[model samples]
Target: MIEALIVGAGVSGLSCGIRLREAGIAAQIWARDMPARSTSSVAAAVWYPYKAYPEHLVIGWARTTYDELMVLRHDPASGIHVRNGHEIFPWQVDEPWWSGAVPSYRRITPAELPAGYRDGYVFEAPVIEMPIYLDYLRQRFEALGGTIEPRTLASLDQALGASDLVVHCSGLGARLLAADSTVFPIRGQIVRVTQVALDTFVLDDYGPSGMAYIVPRSSDCILGGTADEGMEDMAPDLSTAEAIQARCRALEPRLGAAVVLEHKVGLRPGRPTVRLEREQLAGGKLLIHNYGHGGAGVTLSWGCAADVARLIAQA
Candidate 1:
């Protein structure tokens, strides 16, 4: 009967908690903020593998997570919606590197391309409403008899003696707590608007204007975003929000009349590559590092969690 303490209550920590508990380990989470307040809540979390590194491993983790999300979509309470979407490119391109992960991936014909786009691929991907989905995860983790508490730690050593194992899913907090200076912030800003009768999502990662995407949920459409590398400011910039809305509206004219609902800014935990390995400290305790997901935190959550559980089993 091994007990584990996971630091961070965001999607990664919650997902790891669920997997560990299902594997018969007693897992509890401690974090500075709840799911709703964590950076994961601010993501325009459509399942596209963007901004994580070490391409091969990221694709593997993304594929596993895509399948998991697809299964979760069957449960109405999971807040996972499989929406038809296309990622358009400004120039001609071949099939995406992650196309195999998508069950229904296909290249769209020229007739389906938006003006000025030369190539695109369409697929059914999960568009998650973070607020609802985070709550769903929290509830699911709790129903498994796992506990989450509000706590702030000055260092990773603080969690060492409380449990047999400590898993770090602390996101950006890892930069300081784990003393891993490679971790930095990739700031993103997004705008939420009324749904505007849109069903499909549109993503233009390499558009001339910047990284523009429209992710429509059941109630609101999430329009974004900017990937400003090395930016840590969390305050939503009014000009940036306006630019995001403008770019989204250019891509989808129907959004022109959509009223603004809210503006959000989040600092994504960025690193050269995701850190998902284990370390042994003094006193025979185990510490597993699982942060620095950058913009793919939600995209990589389940896959990373499964790997974490496997590591625990082998311990």
Candidate 2:
């Protein structure tokens, strides 16, 4: 029986573990931190392709993920929901390359535009409650005969020695393990507030006001954030939190004095482009690299995992 080992247990690794097992390969995930404790959990986790490139491949992967997420959204236990939201733009622009992936996408009318936005679009997309969704993925992986081990890897060579095929989903850990200098950290911070009676998410990441988004889950809403490139500090800046709250309130006046729940900081795995290719090593061992997804780790999770499984089969 061929066995495979997947490093890192964030959304990417867990998704790959599930798919590999479904492909009739025995696979296990070994991670330094559990999925819930990883950066994937800290994400607002709405399904939008952000900060990932080259546009050609990313659109395909994002479309695949969108279709899969739509199926998962029907299952309440999956912590996935197709919520209506808007992505605001400061200037008139054509629809995004991945706009076709969304089932319901349309330009916002002149009346719908916010105070300073020239154009916008409204669409329904999957919004994942990270904590619950991580658990859902974990349960699904175990049910599919995949296993999770609490282990840390020192280098890719160590993983290659143990299994016939090794999948590297190590996120930012790739900087040290894969010796890829291009992989760095894009630090982000978010503030979680008490649940508001709102289902619509709002994103205004561009323009002079800086990055900001409001994502509502079942129990609470996430107000965010800051994208500080090359910063790895995991401490949530309270000032940033205040700024985020103020901006979100300005976007939607209904967020009046909502109680602050928690502040979170995560170091997003930043890279010029996502790496999802295979490398062959001595002794007939293979290493499939699938990390550096940046903020799209959740957005591209399922599609990337499916592709990784295909790579394993071809190897």
Candidate 2 structure quality by residue, lDDT tens digits, 173-260? 9998999999989998999998879899999988456878999999899999888899988888888888898888888888876899
Q: What are the per-residue Cα lDDT tens digits for candidate 1 across 143-262?
A: 999988998999987888687699999999998899999998898999999988999999998887887999999989999999888898888999999989888988999999899999
TM-score of 2: 0.97
Q: Against the true structure, candidate 1 has what lDDT? A: 0.91
Query: lDDT scores for all predictions?
Result: 0.91, 0.89
If scored against the real structure, what TM-score would every candidate get? Answer: 0.98, 0.97
Name the 10 consecutive residues with the lowest summed lDDT in model 2. 203-212
